[model samples]
Target: MFAPQSDRVALRFGDRSLTHASLAACAGSLARELTGLPRVAVWATPSLETCVAVVAALLAGVPAVPLNPKVGERELAHIVADSAPATVLAAPGVDLPAGLDSVPRRDVTLDGDDPGSFADPGDEAPALIVYTSGTTGSPKGVVLPRRALTSTLDAVAEAWQWTADDVLVHALPLFHVHGLILGVLGPLRRGGTLHHLGKFSTAGVVEALEGDGTMMFGVPTMYHRIAEEVGTTPALAAALGKARLLVSGSAALPVRDHERIATATGQRVVERYGMTETLMNTSVRADGDRRPGAVGVPLPGVEVRLVDDAGSVLDGAGPIGEIQVRGPNLFTEYLNRPDATAEAFAGGWFRTGDVGTRDADGYYRIVGRKATDIIKSGGYKIGAGEIENALLEHPGVREVAVTGEPDDDLGERIVAWVVAAGDAPPSSEELADHVARLLTPHKRPRVVRFVEALPRNDMGKVMKRALRT
Candidate 1:
């Protein structure tokens, strides 16, 4: 069995490297002091220290809720109120919420007694509470058991063939599952070294991968930017090609971005399908074909299917419907909302609330969310993802968000929020024309609004509701 890292480098940010033993010691110290509390809230930056805190909580058998350090007072208060954490551990220099006791992560010192107090948790005990996007309503926490994570880490390690010889250049934030489970836990479980980047700059990531780094994890937005940067320069693209696997998730990976990455750097991005609830369920196989739009077959022990509105299982890939998942990694329940938890499951499968179709080979192709983000216009259902993917193909478009704006004639009109890239920024008319040339008439954006940047939540997902506001 794999034990926690002891001698190898656990985290690397900027110029610093923290060894596994040191990271364990740091977490052990925090765990020792917090033995009285059942839960602790981790409000911190995406750093090596935050990674250590997570491990400490897990090994110490105290569930840790990693809060997005960027949220405002009201949002923080909501999370603190909902989770009811006994203590909040804030990164150094971050302000703490009212009525919450604070501990500066740096000030947490580890000694002999700290490590000695550690206890293994029951496999069925709740380990984490990652909240949903709350796009449709108030965000509810999804409770994951220790066994859920332990199983997920095992599946990912086996599927990816992770090893100490591998190096993961991770750019995603630790607050989310993609960064935490796929980036940190799975890698550490295999004794693989992690080169964690505090902030992503195309140059910085390129520099890190130039070393022994073998893999990378990023959100669609980050990969889009990296692809764009590489498109502008050839040598940089060549350097990026050195990494073996470039994985993306948290949102749909645009086919254009995938093609650009491969064309520029000769590295095919292995886009995976996963969420905060179930960790990683599907991935583009490293040794097999990297299909453009397909998030490859379900991982070991995961059962994926598409069902009609009536909750009846559908036949071979035809019409898209709700995607349901059943696996050992599935969340036990939504933290406090019993109704929502019950409603989320139909029969034995967890209703993903995501619309997708599975191909003959069982690879899943996500169409859009079942909720409001999906746009219906002129008797045709349009996916915001489809239009957004089209907008990303435009050379002058840096970032884009698509939303369904209510229309008088059409049920909903597609409006795009774009971050302009070039000297002659593409006007809404020009972008509309550009999209018109590539997509069906219905898929084109009716209006395009240029913006400094799209609003994103702590998990790096573009807050579509915020864009509409």
Candidate 2:
């Protein structure tokens, strides 16, 4: 919930700006029109219209489903049919694909007057229905309640020391939780200002931070690009050093890149852990130690535990196990999938499907996802994240993804898909020896393949599933 602010600027996109009063007036007008709809769809583009549409839906107490603009025809059709939105909202002049033609279209306009006042939607009310990436099958619509959004935002606000005075800057997409909920709604919930770059660029980051921007949120891919150029670009480093906080999420920020950014800019990028189902679970605190590879402790009111395969809760930090979480920040259910909703929970906790270890201090270091990131070779169950981090430390290695392949002898063998740093890349044997020396002999990649680039999704996370295929 946003507190009343005067005519202060609330959102900025490129040269366009929206004051708190103006945004409320525009969204409130649309909210009046969106009222009584079963559900609505927002063409989640990185623009102010998309922001207005989502906020309007929330104001109207109508569940809003965010559709990725880059979604394929098949996935788009599936989402449209599943959510069955009453109308699709988009910016004027934006061309929506044919998949969305089944629903009527409404263009969001900025010139409307506020619709007096509205009643509070109960905490249990569905605020959003966001679809997952569907790594295994068709993407499932995650139903996020009003309480989940409020609770997660409040928890993170406490963790990050975020307040209305903070001017947030980021270029993350608007479809997923990290970008849409955190990047966009997080600021609004705090009654703070947001400066969204229509597209991410080093120059834009420097300009925003050098001016009024106090915090910046980015994924690993964006930070990696910053790390590569920070050494050569003094302005980039200087601008980053001036920021109050720099956060990275959606995937692990390689320790190598973390160190480079820290060394050059004298700032450690904070990492947080969460998914589509759970808005946020853990985050590195602003007032605490800035650990390079740790995602930090669980947020306030959120419970996290490590569980072994036998469904036993593991204690302490030595052993890596599945991360189970119970929190108010969790989504209510998978839309129309009661079977999935029932299976996702273990007893009372939501199974995150992520494997990690928690130290005695309560800090969490994510190993990787259990489905794609855990590698079983010989008698050891290795996490691909650690191996990827090790490989990234090499001077000749630019970007890398580690996966496991079927092997009759070892059950599964570690394989490295690397993007080289230079023309003369390190040989497979040399790289294998490098990893062996850094980690364990068995942890070394038994098979190495050189590639120009690792396949990545919109969030900059390496699509390991694509590599396996």
Candidate 3:
């Protein structure tokens, strides 16, 4: 979409700003260098260099697989063995493993070559392979196509009314779809400038807001921290008001936190829904009322249905069922995992494994996930999110994770791992009593353990399986 006169900035890092023309030239040169390489693996270390490699790969028709650069040796080795890319673009000083061509940023040469008018790829051709957050154990690479990108961008733009003037403050990482595709690609496709940041801090984010940035994209945890940081500063509060829209994703934004952010920032964080398999399915409106806890109607052209265990569609709004989706943005398949891909789909609709209920107003509320996190206690199904939300309300709690622990009597018991805000947290009995006041007695956490920090994977999702182990 780059024209000679196009007023767009492709990247902004520190004092440097790469124009669309420069970015196009660099991508083409990188593409030329990567010619004949079977695959390119980018260990996503937050940078403009990583962005250049990704866009260059797309333009070059080479499959680019991005791995979590922050992961340890164990996780990193698994990704390298799985994808086996011919070339790797990584941060400087990170030793390259055997049998891969690694290029450092300073060594790469870029003499202008046009990133010619991009011709959108077929619906079946693989464009990118994003790994799931290996919260369970090993992560699976979710293969997405070019059509998925275009279709999703169109749908998102239609539903949220994104414009060329909108500048996005990208706090999320480039490795995750929410951060890279939705945060970077969505705005770029509309000819918007992405004010990129390597890491997020209270002052840095506030500084980005002071610029031309009109929109903000972040996970719920970030909003909570930013809200806390902006407690009583009128200047910071007014700076936040400059943002036209704010999006919350990766995890659902709790009602209390959402309200707290809106009160401090003057912009209600619009909650949306998506995963690695499907880039984005639904989003709250840009101009209308954003209902708390409900991911508003599906984006344009995306079909959503609630189905029971029998795969039969539910007719009422009161019951929660598996949220299934079939859309243009849905991935073509899981990379080389035919059986796993086959298992993910049922009657053409991809089973999201998430349980949700639709309201009369057409808003969808996520209740729980099917496999790893959802817990059933006594005769009632419990969503760990409820307890986690309530736990966050306590002033002593810094972070909380709830999971199902096996029990002989209730079939399953609620176990919570908490990171305390202060040096000393409340006693387990006291914390249990606090949760009991907010949740039903049966739903209250029976086991509360104090920890320095909750174990998390590269993507920042809590590793509940590891916690159980």
Number of the top-ranking candidate, with TM-score as the measure: 2
**50-156 per-residue lDDT for model 1 (tens digits):** 77667777776777888865543434555677888876665556655443543323333333234444556688888888765444434568888888887887876
Write down the lDDT of every candidate, Cα atoms only.
Answer: 0.73, 0.88, 0.74
Error of 3 at 425 (Å): 22
**Candidate 1 overall lDDT versus native:** 0.73
Poorly placed runs, candidate 2 (over 4 Å): 373-469
Candidate 3 regions off by >4 Å?
1-7, 91-112, 117-121, 134-137, 373-469
Per-residue lDDT of 401 in model 3:
93
Q: How many residue-pair clashes does candidate 3 contain?
A: 0
Query: How far is 7's C-alpha from truth in model 2 (Å)?
Result: 1.1
Q: Which ten residues in a row have the lowest lDDT in candidate 3?
A: 99-108
Q: Give the range where candidate 1 is weakest over 10 consecutive residues by summed lDDT.
A: 104-113
Q: Write the per-residue lDDT of candidate 3 for residues 39-91, one digit (tens) a residue.
A: 77886766777777787777776778876554434445656677777767765
lDDT of 2 by residue, 6-120 (tens): 5888889999888888999999999999999999999999999999999999999999999878665656777889999999999999999888888999999999789458788
| Structural similarity to truth (TM-score) of each candidate | 0.78, 0.81, 0.77
Candidate 3 structure, TM-score to reference: 0.77
